[model samples]
Target: MGTESSVKAQAETQIAAVTSLSTPQEGQKNRSSGNFSVENLPAGTYALKFVVEGANSGTHFNVMKDVSGGTDPTIWSHVYSGNTTDVQTDRSFYIANPSGTNSNFTVKVYALH
Candidate 1:
């Protein structure tokens, strides 16, 4: 196959491991709050994007990326913690991806503070 074809194949394989959040469970901490996860991600950086539809007044959501260590067979290290804001009016944000194998991602929602 050609180089372009090979690259496209690799990208497809990587994207296959990425999953989007279909449902967010209401958090016990707050009634307006909720959480969701993107599970079974491969070892690479992924762009975390989201869209919030039908949000009531004073409701907002944020997508955060957290990562653990990929080195050493021992303890895991928290490499990064970055967040993107989605105000009720804006309703969207793009957060950077997590880097590591089997790392988990979460989206948190709450009343505008």
Candidate 2:
């Protein structure tokens, strides 16, 4: 919040971040099974960034957030490369390589709450 915020800026909020490593049975990687839950987040919008390792399945990845506590695969807000987007209205975020396979992966979120 800078020059146009309706409410006066309070204080410098601490940087919030989390990292998770995808685990799929016995040391292998697979899609749809490797996801990290974004829990204990405050009620506000957040910008997310990701770093994926061992990308053997695909280049294009979709980052989705589970607004609800349940890990419902059908309902997710997804973002990716070539698509300009930010600040998902949520209390939790989830990230994973939907097309990834055969390699261990990790996703980190430098969340601005």
Candidate 3:
């Protein structure tokens, strides 16, 4: 019984350590004013929540991932494209303005564990 108790305690301690290590960092970015870019992200999953404001029904904007930073736009991949609506998606490094003279939006980024 002593041996079993010791093993269980050790297991619990290891689990606690791992839990502490794997805790997600609280890094949130709110881009409520205008277009923005989120760079230097570590290798992990992420969540992007955005709201398209003051755009027409079909005003199309794209959320892209700039793997090569801002130097190259040819390599940008559109991770999300939405009109005037509030939607949540994953993975965004940069945001493009909607196609119109008067169209803009806001985005909120959160790290997912």
Candidate 4:
């Protein structure tokens, strides 16, 4: 195989470790999961995946990135919004929340490249 083809093949076979930003829980509307630090990880775009599991129907989710460090954290960016899953990319992220009643959900963060 050519050099370019070899690199592409390696990347395709590599599996990124999935980090759970928050455990599965019954989420409340407008309630934030709070700021999480990805400072230890390398600087690269990451895919934030949110999955709604259990008995929470009609539940929606949203994500924010690079929240301010303070008593009241400010959202730097709103990267995602959906009910089942969000594959939005961001280098830094802070919060993920559910916006419907009885929201049993979880958010998984994984590096993309």
User: What would the TM-scores of all predictions be?
Assistant: 0.24, 0.38, 0.30, 0.39
Report the number of the highest-lDDT candidate. Answer: 2
Per-residue alpha-carbon lDDT of candidate 4 for residues 8-30, written as tens digits (9 for 90 to 100): 32111122222222333346333
Task: List model 2 lDDT by residue over 9-70, tens digit each.
Answer: 43322223333334323452323333454444444535444444455434334554443564
Off by over 4 Å in 1: 1-3, 9-31, 42-45, 55-60, 64-113
Clashing pairs in 1: none
lDDT for each of the candidates? 0.28, 0.41, 0.31, 0.39
Residue-wise C-alpha lDDT for candidate 1, range 15-79, written one tens digit per residue: 11122232333341211122233434344423332323332222233333322342212111222
| Pairwise TM-score winner, candidates 2 and 3 | 2
| Candidate 3, superposed: residue stretches over 4 Å from native | 1-46, 64-70, 74-93, 107-113
For each of the candidates, give the backbone clash count: 0, 0, 0, 0
RMSD of every prediction: 15.0, 7.0, 15.5, 7.2
Where does candidate 4 clash, by residue pair? none
- Show model 4 residue runs off by greater than 4 Å: 1-29, 43-59, 65-93
